[model samples]
Target: MTAVLNAVPETSFAEYEALKAVLDTASRRMAITVVGEVNTQGRAFAVHVATLGTADPLAPAIGFFAGIHGLERIGTQLLLDYMRILLCRLEWDELLVEQLRSIRLVFMPIVNPGGMWSMRRSNPNGIDLMRNAPLSAEGQVPFLAGGQRIGPWLPWYRGRVGAPMELEAALLLRVVEEELIARPVSFALDCHSGYGFRDSIWFPYAKSTRHIAHLPEMYALKAMLDGAYPHHRYVFEPQSVQYLAHGDLWDYAYDRVRAPSVFLPLTLEMGSWLWIRKNPMQLLKREGMFNPIKAHRTERVLRRHTDLLDFLARAAYGAPRWLPQGTSRQHMMSRAIELWYRRRRA
Candidate 1:
């Protein structure tokens, strides 16, 4: 374990090797599955899904996902750090062991290994996985950043029209549907970087400005976060607030699960611009734009989000206690609209 943590992985395969090491250590406690494989160049990269705790469909589940964009490797690294911590604690953390019995934890730390290996934002075929979903935006979107169908040569390229989803995107959806959407209550946090000046926690509706049906639930979750961590800094809102994009995977997945079942999918967009601001020299390199170049900064980034991740896990475990109800739900809905929607309208 020490060797795995200390070693600096130079390639996506090395990152996978490190993950396998941690999985081997906790093999007895987890149900590990290789959902699919992405063949790029001459090598095949296997996509893995690992679950811990009760398998009951009614139990609350929380999933942590990263590495959808190959350029944003920090998200994958952050999750790997968290997974290692949880796996190590399983040996002696009695409280965590007890918590796991009542809740489920799912992980898919490296969703696009081929893209990671190539150091590109898109997959080997050049299609942007996040933009490969069939969904389309209802309102006007930014010229290209909002996603385009011109060709894979451009960034944020949606695949050819009427085509099936990319392998990585399809596999990710399969894991979410099987492990998360099936549960009565579930939460998913997908990590990412290379965005704004401050780290932001964004919810669904990347395709439109309309609010999600679970606005009250989203408000309740944000309220819990505020009450628990008063000093924390996170812009909690819908992804549409920043920019509308076509084919957002979360929007597509969130729409599939109906009422009586709740699935709150979030994207943690870590602000890499701050790192660039601190060290302007990073602009000279492509990877540096999305990742911290300095070791100390990287360590800080790894430690920063652990609390939020742990809080989400605890929140999922105690969903019934905080999820809004009846009158309280109505109040939350009003507050959510006022806070998010009304402001945008103005």
Candidate 2:
């Protein structure tokens, strides 16, 4: 049969089921609720939420998600991998478990279920969900889209001025409003991919605002993330302004709540190329997902898996600013010791 990860029927199901499991575990590991969802194209998509370390419901939280664009399947898969780690790797990451016990972790694994099934970037309506966030009354993509020049949403289809959330955004923002934002969250992150971009941990309104007070925290967090995976440059900044990404998820998060929000485009830096073998855009029918890799096996990809676990564990357990340092160096050291032992044995 076709090789897929776990019992995940496809990447879409992987997102759905992972959220279900995370929500279900909240009952045992923390306090949570279904939060709710909106069905598009007959699929029941939801934004799952959980609370920990307090009763104020509006307490600060750390959120993670994938599949907003739909075509960005790598993130969709990575989030799924995260769910499994959050659930099953409790022993391997006790510090992370303790951290989760302290800070609420909201997982919106599939923001565009319709797109997940179709392998498109936008939601089912052919709208780019990233650009679909709520916009100003004048209808712009926020301060970044194109300066005042690119008016009224074309080329981006950012959505109408007053449209609620473009589906998922509304639901997610609702959860934050009722729970995290109005309450206490001081930090949060949104995961994405593309550009094969390096050192891309970015903040909102990359160009305009000089909310410099927060730069140190951003750099500290960035250094921790970079240390976790040093293969790429640590490209952290306020994000660009020429793109004027209005109604963006990060824009809304930063502007409304003024939290230290991060948009991590964790693009893969390895030799692997997504479309080189099976096109990332290919659709799946009854015949099964086209040319997908079976769930990763062996240590070759173990570091990617480890990097994720480490990031979450560090976020949950270590102080928000600290991460394991010299991981690449540590690996080399361990290898050298092993080689020495082998030579001695010979």
Cα miss at 95, model 1 (Å)?
Answer: 1.2
On a 0 to 100 scale, what is the lDDT of residue 14 in model 1?
53
How would you encode candidate 2's per-residue C-alpha lDDT over 1-346 as one tens digit per residue? Answer: 1233367753345556655655566466555556566566666665555544444354345555566666555555565556555666664867665665555665566667776666665566656666665543233334433323244333345655555557666766666555555543344445555443241455655323333333334445555666767874435545542233555565665556544432222222222333223444333332112213433422223335446534643454344334223564355434433432234346
lDDT per model vs. reference: 0.90, 0.50
lDDT of 1 by residue, 1-346 (tens): 2365467455445567777876787688888899988888877888888899888889999999999999898898888889888988989999999899899999998899899878899999999999888999989999999999899899999989999999999999999998999888999999999667999999999999999999999999999999999988899999898889999999999999988899999999999998999989998998989998888898998888999999999999899898989999999999999999998899
| Per-prediction CA RMSD (Å) | 1.8, 10.9
In model 1, which range of ten residues has the least summed lDDT? Answer: 1-10
Candidate 2: stretches off by over 4 Å: 1-14, 17-27, 30-32, 50-60, 91-94, 136-155, 183-185, 197-199, 206-213, 226-234, 258-309, 312-346
What's each prediction's TM-score?
A: 0.96, 0.65
Q: Estimate candidate 2's RMSD in Å.
A: 10.9
Show pairs that collide, candidate 1: none
**Displacement of the residue 150 alpha carbon in candidate 2, Å:** 11
